[model samples]
Target: MTGPDKDEAVERAELLLALRKRGIRDRLVMRAFEQVPRERFVEPVFRNLAWNDQALPVDCGQTISQPTVLALMTTALELEGTHTVLEIGTGTGYYAAILGHIAGHVVTLERFRTLAEAAARRIGSLGLANVEVFLADGRLGYRARAPFDRIVLGAAVEEVPSALFDQLAPNGILVAPVGPPEGTQALMRYRRGPEGLEQRELGLVRFVPMLSGVAAVL
Candidate 1:
């Protein structure tokens, strides 16, 4: 297909520019976000609005995270190539793809079997072999791949899951949106230091509630 029209291109440019405006200055993070086509991750009906700085609905009541929020969460983690990352809530597998681009290996968990399968296919088709998608309750983390160098939750949880904290390696980082069920969510960054786990509230943000157990329908 032809490239987006001038107005559409301007909108797309503004999206990334807005992210930079919000202090998502990490070059690697920005490049990865630009490289991965957000348009491909959403349904065809929403493709025209893909570049907008807004969440669009996908299958199974899940929404593709807004790009600014995604960049914020990713930049907070500060991933490196050697880090083995575990991602919770593999919605559309877009965030996992970004993590896979920066980290050594990314093990992403999805509670819905259908989402997991779709993510697996998307990642494979993209030729991202470093990513492994799992259909499991992400709140438990992945014991088989314990000792993650970094853990990122795509959905918001009321509290950090103890199991996830245990799975983090010494000096590892965990970034998530934590707070009440409503709109008041804080983007928190937890570091498992030699002394103990330390938490810092980065900024206010919002995300879909992180749920336990698989989707009953799917």
Candidate 2:
């Protein structure tokens, strides 16, 4: 292999090792992390640091989530191969791609059309046919495809939106970061059971605020 290719392989190996050290234990989640090349989803300027465990700026003043956080959130979902997932934020399409690798289908909503379109193109280039990127208000969830077996919100909100709960199927799991926009958030997992919505605190995290309405940008 060429020098750059060899270097990237080494970087990727180190990334996986870091993730494993940081408590990423699920074999399927680990495999998804390895198979999906993060460098492909990041902006070209930030591609060199793609394997590093850090959040990088994307368009629309948004940030792609750190690798460890992404893996932790995905692992928390406890995804099955037959599940359909709704992803609230499609930033750079990285997390959605991971879901696409593990789930039957992924419907990811991005508030900004530009981000949505760019993410869609990137996901398409990777031939992840099960993932769909849509420009919409994530706070409302995607009603047309309601009753998702799994849902993940890439942004932070003070409280879980009732609309999102309505979209979840029975026994469905939704994982998200919950807190005020400017403060540290808790990574929460909510499961819809016959008894009602059961909540669990996974850990502490920070993410961009979950905004209302779609962006006017094209």
Candidate 3:
């Protein structure tokens, strides 16, 4: 506990406090936030800002989501140790890395090859064996790993894609932002019930729009 180690610890504490003030009380989500090192997920140039309550840029124009948003969304999922999670956006794999500590397995998708490859490397370096990164259109969902216990979309969409709904296991939970790409989106949580899908509105948030098809350009 010296030099950068001490500084990072302090920053992490402050970040957690901020999350608490924002009303995120889920113990498991807080523990995951405290455990994952967000600095490792951002570009080296922006590492200094990693602990700040704001999104920071990564490669391929993607930004590592603000810790507050991540914490809130994770809390909304009410994850369990046995749950298998699906993450739609894998920017820097930070969220996936956090989920790795909570969920049994995390399967994350990144449309950009560079982001997906780089995220895989970072997650590997952390030795998170339960997390897997894929380069593909997140909208399609992963049928091979169908019926996820929990699914979260990192980017904003006009509505939750039908494909994602199909992939959710019975009684599964899902969280996403739903609204027009240019306007503020409502953060929503959905649960598949015996009769139909039950929805709850969490809050408003702005995120990069969800795009279809795998990215061709860098």
Candidate 4:
């Protein structure tokens, strides 16, 4: 930790240790979290806090989800190497990077064009060719890439959008927080079945409300 480079390395090591201590033991997920430098996904003003296990403010008034939350959601998806994953609410593109590590392909949607562009550049810099960034409303879900094996919404939606549910392949899984925009929300997982969608509420969590429509400024 004497020089900037050394310090950054030590910080990343400690962050990984913290994640391990928190029971994030899945080798693939842990490796993905460690390999993707959280600092690169955060603004320079908040770079020092990137290693902290908390949400960091990102562009468009959104927050890059806390590491624990990200792990939980990603784990819930149960992504297989060949599965195609769709991520709503791209935010800082951090989640997409992690998904790319686990899934065969990732299609992420963002409402803010500026945030989407920045995320695209960062993902490109990392040489993640599997992640396709879209500057569009996530609520609509990417129809062209329908029947996703796993769908993850980074923001909290008031209710599960029927459109998104329809896009899931049979037996596919979707994870998102559902409830009122202002109050507490429950992270729920839905698995498509022949009978219908089977839901299992996981836990209580807070997230920025998933907005409708695109941001004018982007």
Candidate 5:
């Protein structure tokens, strides 16, 4: 491959190195990031920004979060290959693809019908059979598939929904950006152990607010 394909390959390699230098320490998470091509999830006009450490606009006024944030949150989960994962905020289904690559199965939720449908197509295009995308309210989670071994909330929320907590399996790890909708939010990791729920902050990040109810047609 020559021209743009070659340039993108070069840029993707450099981006992986940059992510490592920035503290993406989990080997599995890093490998998943390495394997999932970011360009496929972004619009053609924004393909050039796919490898950058920045979020890009997507359908439904949402954004595909930057790779750094995705990697950090994923690493915090300490995800195991056998774990079943639930991702709240499918966006472009980018991170879900990464999770699918690293975990046993991934169920991602998006409030927007269009984004959910598009993301499903994107994941399917990659031939990731372990990943499933749904059009639903992320706040409620996918109840039929409860007790997820790992849960990642892609959007920031002022309060972590109790329903999601109920969906987390015992000894599971759930990572989310929790704080006010505006300004910076704490990237929190919650571990549900036999003793109780343990909490820790991964770092700070800015994400679009996680909304309730399904989005109406635009």
Candidate 6:
């Protein structure tokens, strides 16, 4: 391989090893992380650190989540090949691209129009046909395409929004970070069943706050 390709390969390998050491055991989740180039989702200034296990700022004051958190959330979702996913924060579109690799379809919503447009362009350039990016209020969820088999929120909130639960299909799984935006949050998973929504706390995490309404920026 060329020098850059070899370096990227090495970085990817090391990253996968680190994730495995951190107890990320799902093969599909690992493969998705391996396949998606994190550099493509980060700002040019932070491209060199793309493979590092840390969140990095993108446009619109948002951040692409750390690889470990993304993997954990993906694992919690328990996605199947046929599942359609609703992603609450598109950010740099990196996570949505990863979801595209594992799920049948991904509908991602971003409050910032600029971020949504950039994410759409990036996902399109990658030819990730299964993923769609939209500029909208994520808290409201996408009712037009209600009944998603899987839903993931990249931002943190005090609690899971009821609107999202209404959009989840029976037996669907919704994974999100729940807590105050300034402090540590719990990575939670909610499964819709015959009885109701079943909740599980995966781990503590930190993420940006889940905001309401669309961004005012043109």
Q: lDDT of each structure?
A: 0.88, 0.92, 0.91, 0.88, 0.89, 0.91
lDDT of 4 by residue, 64-183 (tens): 998988888887888899999999998889999999988999999999988998999999999999999998888888899888999999888888888899899999999999987777
Work out candidate 4's RMSD over C-alphas. Answer: 2.1
TM-score of each: 0.93, 0.96, 0.95, 0.94, 0.95, 0.95
- 4 or 5, greater by TM-score: 5
Per model, state how many residue pairs clash: 0, 0, 0, 1, 0, 0
lDDT of 3 by residue, 1-218 (tens): 21344587788898999999999998889999998888888888877778888988777777788899888899989899999999999988999999999999999999998888889999999999999999889999999999999999999999888999999999999999999988789999999999999999999998989988898568
Look at candidate 4 and tell me the lDDT of residue 192: 95
Candidate 6 at residue 25, lDDT? 97
CA deviation > 4 Å runs, candidate 3: 1-6
Of the two candidates 1 and 3, the one with more favorable lDDT, higher being better, is: 3
Q: Highest lDDT: give the candidate number.
A: 2
Residue ranges of candidate 6 with Cα displaced over 4 Å: 1-6, 216-218
What would the per-residue lDDT of candidate 2 be over residues 1-218, giving only the tens digit for each residue? 21345588788888899889989899999999999989988888877788888899999989999999999888889999999999998989999999999999999999998999989998998899999999999999999998899999999999989999999999999999999899799999999999999999998998999989999594
Candidate 5 wrongly placed segments (more than 4 Å): 1-6
- Clashing residue pairs in candidate 3 (N, C-alpha, C atoms within 3 angstroms): none
| Model 1: CA > 4 A from native | 1-11
Show the colliding residue pairs in model 4: 114-218
